[model samples]
Target: MSIKKLQIPTYLSALSVMIFIIVLTFFLIVGKSLLIPLFLGGFFAILFTPFSNWMESKKVPKILSSVISLLCMALIVGGLLSFIVGNVASFTSDFDDVTSKINTYAQRIDEWTQSTFKMDYEIRNKANPDYLKRVLKENSSNISDFAMKTVGSLSGLVLIPVFMFFFLLYRHHLTQMMIMIYRDRDPNLVKMRITSLRKVILHYIVGVGKVMIILAILNISAYSALGIKHAIFFGVLGALLNIIPYVGPFFGVLLPVIYSFLTKDSLFYPVAVIVCYQIIQMIEGNFLTPKIVGGNVNLNAFITFLGLLIGGTIWGVAGMILVIPAMAILREIFDLSNTTKPFAYLMGEEKEKTQKNEKPEADNESSE
Candidate 1:
């Protein structure tokens, strides 16, 4: 008996795959509104499942239990938003002081410009005194369009909780449906696959949450020690933004640094803010993430950065938030197939020498 190779001819297969990808991308873009909400709903549903299950085990009705679990999630999100808004409102209440600081900074900049460039700052200002006003007047329609888009985005936020509630209510049915779809595979293997996927998604989300909380505490302590006002607000906001990975830490630090400079008499305070955040971020990147998140997602730096860029391009902030989990899901799918396992290996982190040698070394020791 002869074994048959499973290879398809290159060009025809490649063309078919390319066409499929194009159609998939088209639908993704066109159906983003419907899809984005569903994805977010699925995400929160997974997070809230344990609470709902516990309530059920205690003989609570499913609908009521789901409502209670959802309320818990809402309160947590609402508390964070309220904290941020309160701090911002307090800062804004001192508007006059902020304007005075801005004026002082502008005057210093003008003076430096005059001395360094041998130009009269007043003459340059006179040349463009109405330039900003003229530009704003011309772009009034664009401003209106942006405002409209923002309002639309906010309204979409309402649908998320509704979707999440339903997802939680029907989670058991959904799990069974997924298993049914894989009925062609071995029953035990399909069950194992579903279980593994659930565990990976839940573990990744929980681990990331733990890391964020730890960072928030560290950030708050550092800011308080530096005498920054509204330390908790800045720290929490920064920690939340840090979820975006590489670009996020820089932006997280930038907000506090700017606030310190604008609100303080000395430039040194802003510098201190930057230095403090950098140290915390360094520790977070090297220690906290590895220990907490471990190798759950196992994606490499290049792939991660590339995912961020593509995600940002496609769906803005929502894409960036959802992309890592999407990658994890894709990696798991790829690993399940012998033909696609190589792709999964590529998505994973580069192999460390010690890890690569461990199996061989163990075998050698055993033989000895």
Candidate 2:
């Protein structure tokens, strides 16, 4: 007689998966302090892989090659960083003007509030013209606090370069480890996924970097023509923020417009800045990004926006920045198996692209 198989209830299995996801999310939120640097290092490690390979092709030692790769990365990063810092220092040299203007605005707001709401004399009297200056001076210590809370604030960050070094050094071994984790599956298939993952990640990072450089140059030129103070600083900063996808460019332009509104005599400068930024953004969205990045990530707009919101909520700006690559990598993983193929579809633009392709085919067939 054939033995009856033990069948699990479908609802139970679904519930188990739900519980697993919740538990996993909790752990991710809690463990981000440790995970953030490691994740960053792993990605940067992937980015530097080609450079390290090139070094190895020249008969360089593996460890030495990794070191050389890190050095190269450091030099490029340092050059850009130094430029930003120099511009920032120049910008801050005019801090008193900006601060004084802001103080004037704040005092006006306070007076308006006092009149509009009819607050007690105590509250009204509390509004000193010098209150803003006093608060800024008193809270000078808060600058350190703010820095300490920044994305790279954690002490674990020091290990990022270390992590990158070891990761690059043992890149092959890590790939092998990933393969071994799925050793039950076809090794070749697993290896293909790994290779694709690395390629997609590297392409995305490099493409984004190239786009940022282009944007920065374009922005600096435009801002200089408009005579925007701190042109270099704002230009580079806005470019840095463009890594966050859609929302970043908005805030990037908003700052300069607000400053111009407050500082400049005529409203023309602020209005011109807005018009110029919108024109640049139009070109960037329509031509530059598509031509450069070429939909390698292949994410859908709805999902991308949702990911930005969820990422920003969870880990702030760093999350927003990292979520794109993270989702792309996850899609690669999901694509590895038949069971997960639906998830891969959910994450990718394959269906949408297919629909578009079919429309033209249908038109041609009807015409024929």
Candidate 3:
């Protein structure tokens, strides 16, 4: 007599997976303050690995190389922030003018409506020119509260570079530890998969960088042609926000439209801005990203959108930013195991073979 293999019920397997996910989510939410920076650091480490290695090859100590890498990153980020802050300072300085213009516009629209349609354009008593100003004034406390919270989170911000530094310094040790942890599996397969994941992530990042540069050029040209105020500011910012996916592009469009409305003499400018941006958006989404970024990611649109929502819900903006890379990693990791291949398929953009490409079942039966 021979023993047969034991089978786990499908329901039991699914339930176990669900329980694991629930537990993992709970932990992520609980430890997010620490985890967020650590995750960000790990990503930066991955992105900087090649640069770090180049420094090491020149006989620089690992610690010093890591520090140098972090400094480079800081300078890049510092410059971008400086650009935005300097422009934003000037933009915000004219808030009184923005409010005044909006109020005047509201009053004019109200007059037109009352004369033409015989009703007040009754959104927050638009008849009152000061209503818009009052609304902003009333929300000042809430704005200050948000600013305070952002300032409070600088502690976590401070930890990001620290984590990146250590990650780079001990990158080899970390690889070894991972391989040792998977002692039962062939270490070669583990190493191969890890390398593949890094390449994919790196290529995706480089592609994204290219997309940003192209978008920045296009946005600045369009805004400049339209004579939009702070053309460089909006263009650079819009390009930057595209990194966030779904909601990002919307806000990217919204910002210019708001400014155009506030500062321009006519409604035509805002509509023109929207039209120009949409054409550019179509080109970026349909062509640029698909050709450049999508290949490395290999995630279908549905899964990507779902990931963005779940990430946003879990960790707010940071979660949204990190989730795509996390999904890319998980999808690739799933591909490593036969048991997890279905999940990989679910998360990926790969297609199945057509009926015409497959051998018929009747042919197999005849051969058997």
Candidate 4:
């Protein structure tokens, strides 16, 4: 074949890939208003599928099953919100006391720094106290602004359960539609790929849900044992943030550290609180996650981390939570095609298995 022929095909392939990426990015950016609720609805629908199925097995009608599942979800969410609100109200009411304790803690830290560093106390005071106070004040305002904006944005999230209900009600038809769309070109391949994608997403959702619940319980227990104020609030916050992947573990640590700094008169308490978070994360990552999630979703550590970073950049925290499952679905689709199988393997855990046996068979066939 002529050089031009080979070059044209390669160039066209590259262009197609680039265009697909650009289109996807644009959709993610512009479709947020519609996409956010739809995505959340889909996610919750999937999570609640088993419950709906169980209700059906017990002779409940499909509509009733969906309604019951949705109501259960609503009750859980309302309970959690009430707990968080109550704790926040109590904490705010005691704000003056908390501020006084924080100031005393700061003084102790300053004294310790002076003694440990053997620095001139007057110079250190001039450099540190003003800057720290200003930063803290700005951070507090920013946090308040962020919370208000989040609440404003989430006011529409009530639509999620509504969407979820219909999704569950007609899930069988939806799956059938999906299969029909892909069946014309390659039915077997399409079905396999879809099945793989579903397994990956379902396993991840169920696994993470269990992990978050356990971590929440452990954190609440630990905080209670340590006599931390607002134990339930911090524990629940940690669990929710943990859904955001890598950065979430750090966020989980930050809540308790801030509480310790604001409520106790010693840096030791904050350090201990941070240490506790680290320990919990270590347990979750090494033990709980591996056992629960297994190796079902095949994205490697680097790609997984990159997916989170890019997803967060594109769609904020919700993106961070959704990206891994989305990527897994994409990987499943790619793995179905001979042309794109390599890309799927690149994002997968089965790289060695994919390489060693398949290539040799292909080489031998070519030689024959």
Candidate 5:
């Protein structure tokens, strides 16, 4: 065969993949309004499927079973949101006091910087009426824009539960359709793969949820003991942020530390808050996640970071939340195929890479 013939197919394959990715990314960005809820509903449906299954096994009608399952989930979510809102309301009531303290700290920090480094921080003039007016004037449009966006998102929230309900109702049909799509494969193997996919994905998401709850309890107790204001709010926020991997815990700690610094006169409370979060993070990373989640994604630091960046870029916060489990599901699929097993290995931890490479090196040495 001519070199051109081989090169033509290879170039065509690369071009096709590039085009596919570009089209997919465009659709995802444009159709986020439609897609986000659908994705969320699908995930929730996965989580609630067992409950529906149990209800079906008990001779309950499928439609009623799905409704009950959705209602149960809604109640849990509503209770959690209500609790958070209560704490947020309490925090808001003290917002003026927090604002005053923050301004005071900002003034002191501005003075310190000027004295220490001879750098005049322009923000010190922010307290001036003229400066304040200008700032408000400049930000007025932004504030209005933000409020509009918030209203839009709130409207979107109503559709989520509705989507989730129907997803749950029709999940069996969906699953059967998925299996049928793979009819070219051996029926038993396809079934097993589907089963494994469901089990792994469900376990990963549920395990993460369990870990977050435990972290919240730990954070709240520690913050309470240290006498931080809005301990529940900060703790829960920290727990939620822990959903993102490495960078999240730092942010979780940073926010409370800033709040504690501004609210409390004593430096000790802020220090204590930092120490507490660091210790909690150490425990969670070293013990809790391993004991609970355990090798679900098995993605290396490189792959995880890359996934986070890509996911965050594509879908913002929702993308970050969804990407890790999506990667885990992909890893599971890759593992099932001999051709893709190497790609799966690449996604695994450093130790796996080291071991795999060492085996080949050892074999080569033995032959030598």
Candidate 6:
């Protein structure tokens, strides 16, 4: 008996995989420079869309409105930068003292371990000191490199705002172009998808913005009450870091903890810092987010954490901050197609009883 031969497209499959890997690597290398600005521009454009629409309603020219919006953003950022610059000396001094205090704490820990555990201090210190020093050196180098690269890139492109201005100026045309490109057969479906995406992105921007503001205020108030040095600096830092989700809160708390440890002999200060962060996080999770973001875009905690992790791994802090909004947008797109609707359901906000109870009008119409 002759066995039937199996025909496999091995070469094609291998070639496909290789091509994908190469493409991915190419994007990863260039994405830092290109994608960051593109994404930031896109997000800002979305955030400003409502204002643009409002301007149009008032009979403002799109170009003028776009310019005004960009100007407003620049002024806001410039004011924040001025605030930071004004307090830079205090922030730097506090940070340096905090670093010294952390080193002292480590030394104390080493002594305690030697006394209690009867460990060899010299051997342990020798084994770990070089490793810690090397790690710190590398981290410092990476930070410096990143700063230089960012500044270099920004200097090279003095025309980004010009690009953004045109992008926003022709924003309506861009949406129309997208619809024209994709809506050959089903205009209604394409329109629905666009509508959903706009809603998701808008809600996310507004919600996250409000949350950050609240966290900033809470941090500032708590640090002021504790009499921590550079309270404004730490508050602003916390607000910026809060954009990074789960890991952000830990880093936000770290600055104050280190400052408290350095400036105060009492351990209560550190404890108070931790308690304040926990309380603020609780308030954010329980009260502020629900009210501001509403229940329209509920995400599962585990998935949210996973998105943060994956995004951070790929694009560092920026990716982590963007992941939820990206996920929301993706979910909306997936929900537009019948084949991918299940995936959307998995990612989307849980439906209320009233929404669930509503019969499908399309189904009823079709039956008639």
Best by lDDT: 3
Tens-digit lDDT track of model 6 for 1-368: 99999875989877997999789757855666666556666777778888988998899988889988888767775687666555643443334344445556667778888899987465433444345444544553354345334423664234445656767898768777888999665777766767668777888888878888988899999999998878877888788777677798788789678667767867899899999888988998789888988754667677788888876766666667777888877777787689788888787656564465565765777799
lDDT ranking from best candidate downward: 3, 2, 1, 5, 4, 6
TM-score of each: 0.85, 0.84, 0.87, 0.81, 0.82, 0.76
lDDT by residue for model 3 (90-112), tens: 65444567656766677787878
lDDT of 1 at 246: 86
Each candidate: what lDDT? 0.80, 0.80, 0.82, 0.77, 0.78, 0.72
Q: In terms of TM-score, how similar is model 3 to the real structure?
A: 0.87
Name the lDDT value of residue 137 in candidate 6.
Answer: 41
CA deviation > 4 Å runs, candidate 4: 1-8, 105-155, 185-195, 351-368
Superior candidate under TM-score, 3 versus 6? 3
How should the candidates be ordered by TM-score, best one leading? 3, 1, 2, 5, 4, 6
Best by TM-score: 3
Give the TM-score (vs. native) of candidate 4.
0.81
Query: Root-mean-square deviation of each candidate, in angstroms?
Result: 4.6, 4.2, 4.3, 5.6, 4.9, 7.3
Off by over 4 Å in 3: 1-6, 122-124, 127-152, 351-368
User: Taking the tens digit of each residue's C-alpha lDDT, what string does model 1 give over 121-176?
Assistant: 66334444245334434453353343234223554567678888999998878778
For model 4, residues 134-212, the per-residue Cα lDDT tens digits are 5654554454345433322654366678888988998878777887987676766666665566667888888888888
Error of 4 at 102 (Å): 4.1
What is the clash count for each candidate, in the order shown?
0, 0, 0, 0, 0, 0
Cα miss at 279, model 6 (Å)?
1.0
Flag the better candidate by lDDT, 3 or 6. Answer: 3
